[model samples]
Target: MRAIGTIWMVARREVKARFLTKANLVSLGLLLLAVVAGVVVMDYFQNRDTDEPTFTIALAEQTAELRPGLEAAAAGQDTTLDISTMGAAEAEEAVTEDLDAYISGDPAQPEVLVADEVDGQLLGLVTGVAQAHAMGSEVAALGGDPGAVSEAVAQAAPDVRSLAEEDPSGGMFGPAYFVAILSTSVLLFALISTGALIAMGVVEEKTSRVVEILLATIRPASLLAGKILGIGIVGLIQVVLLGGAAIGTMAATDLLADFEIDLTTAMLMIVLWFFLGFAIFALLFGGFAALVSRQEDIGSVTTPLTFLLFVPYYVAMFMVPNNPDTTLTAVLSQIPIFSPFMMPMRSAFDAVSTGELVLSVVLALATIPLLVWVASTVYQRGVLHTGGRMKLSEAFARR
Candidate 1:
């Protein structure tokens, strides 16, 4: 009870010292604005009218039988066709911007009248449709049903299989991939920034000999816990606000109408991984910072740990999106340290099994206690050592 009370007091002090400051407030506001601006930009690009060519084709009564085939072929090639029924003479007269081409005369050998040079796609569709129409006529003349023969030809397409598996996130260009990229980016930024803050705070306290004063009253482990908790709370607030703003912007704009993504589950996973990842990195930063009394030397001890954080970050960014189901990604995601960065992305793509998720969670949770022991031991031994920088080996060794 006493330790808990002391820790709470320390945490409250940290929150007041850090979160309630004017600088922090202004920075938070700027970050929110940036998120909202980025979302709006993405929405603009995503929902804007496309510049793909649309062919305005007019069909006369004589060539009306080519409508279905022409329309289907145009659609298959991703071309838009504005088809309308009209007389051949009227279509030829109205061939300014309103009409591109008009098909007249016989259905089998259609007279395709164009305003100028013919569009390759438009011409190909017309030629193919006429040929198919002629073939169907031949089939009808041979006492075979034209519709049944067409259906048989359509069903005769051979099945194709690829050796490379299709990407679940739709080839790294989909909305789900964007969400995963954003989530991992947030995780990396939050973890690295918070971890750096924790280290700097520890070094700042040591430089002013404030840790000694705080240590006289509270246990070192409790003090460390409180500081991490306080800074973590501030970080979580930033993440939640930014994430919510982006999500709200996307929803309002209907930017992801074509793709299905569960914002709730994605947000939940980010928070979960962040908490676990923070625990691991925060403890290390706090422990390492204790080894140095001067702020100048703080980076020497924490630099290696920063690199460690980036290893998982780069892997999550480059590898996971491309090959979420690969053996390397699967194995790394299940590991305790890497899970914080890897699992959320894997889960987002619906690539992770329940067993894998359970195992990853268990491993990460199990590792925290071990880290707590190691970090507290290092901090306990190193916090009081002043002047010269203490070696990590000396911190772990009992006096």
Candidate 2:
């Protein structure tokens, strides 16, 4: 009870001191605003090329059969396209009037008439429709079922299926991938920012000898835990706010209408992995920063840990996108350092089994006690012995 109370007391103090400051609150607000701006920017790029579509494509008599193919081609593209079949003269008349283009052919050549030289999307649609019809005709002449071939292609092109062994997030491709990317990015940002706060706070106290006085009243482990706990809570709040703002912006602008992005699932992943990633890096950060009293030396303390962190981070951000089922991903998923970063993505894609998740958490937890012991020892020895940067070997040796 006494130790818990002391830890809570320190945690409460840290939280208040950090967040109650005018500067910190302002900065936090700015970060949330930046998230909104980023979401808006993403939205703009996503829907930019699509204009207010009201297009009429006149089809000559022979080309009338290409309507089904044209409709299929335009299925998921969400365009308002009108296809009207008429005589060649009427089609040409329609083009000179209000129609955007005309697709015509049969014993002549597949052609699209437009005011401009070429419009890629429109031309492609006309070509695809005419080609599909030609293919169907050729198959019929060859005594094959054109209907069967079309039934297969029509079943494919625009729809989705989930035959992959491990599904992430139990959602579709677009949503699952979006959530995975966001989760990795947010988890990385939150852990680094909060861990640095812990490191900087430790250096500040040590430089002023404030820690020396606090040590008489509390154990080093308790103090470190409290600071970590405090700053971690604040960091989590920031993540939630930033995420909520981004989501809100997307919803308001309807930028995500086409995507199935499961924000809820991703947020849950963030909460679960954030603590694990933060703990591993934060303990090491606090322990290492104690070796240097000067604030300028902070970078040296954090750089090594950052490099170690960045390895798994890069894997999650870059490599995972390319191939999640590779042996390397499987191997890294078992490691505690990498699991916190990697497992969430697997879960997001529903590629992870329950057993895998449980095992990864257990492995991550198993390492915590050992690292906590090592980190606390380093903190105890090096916090009081700072002149220049204390070598990590010296800290281990002295401890």
Highest lDDT model number = 1
- Overall lDDT per candidate, in order of appearance: 0.85, 0.80
Q: Write the per-residue lDDT of candidate 1 for residues 49-135, one digit (tens) a residue.
A: 543569888899878878999888787778889998898557868776578888889999998887788888788889888988999
Q: Report the error of model 2 at residue 256, Å.
A: 5.1
Error of 2 at 238 (Å): 1.6
Model 2 weakest 10-residue run by lDDT: 166-175
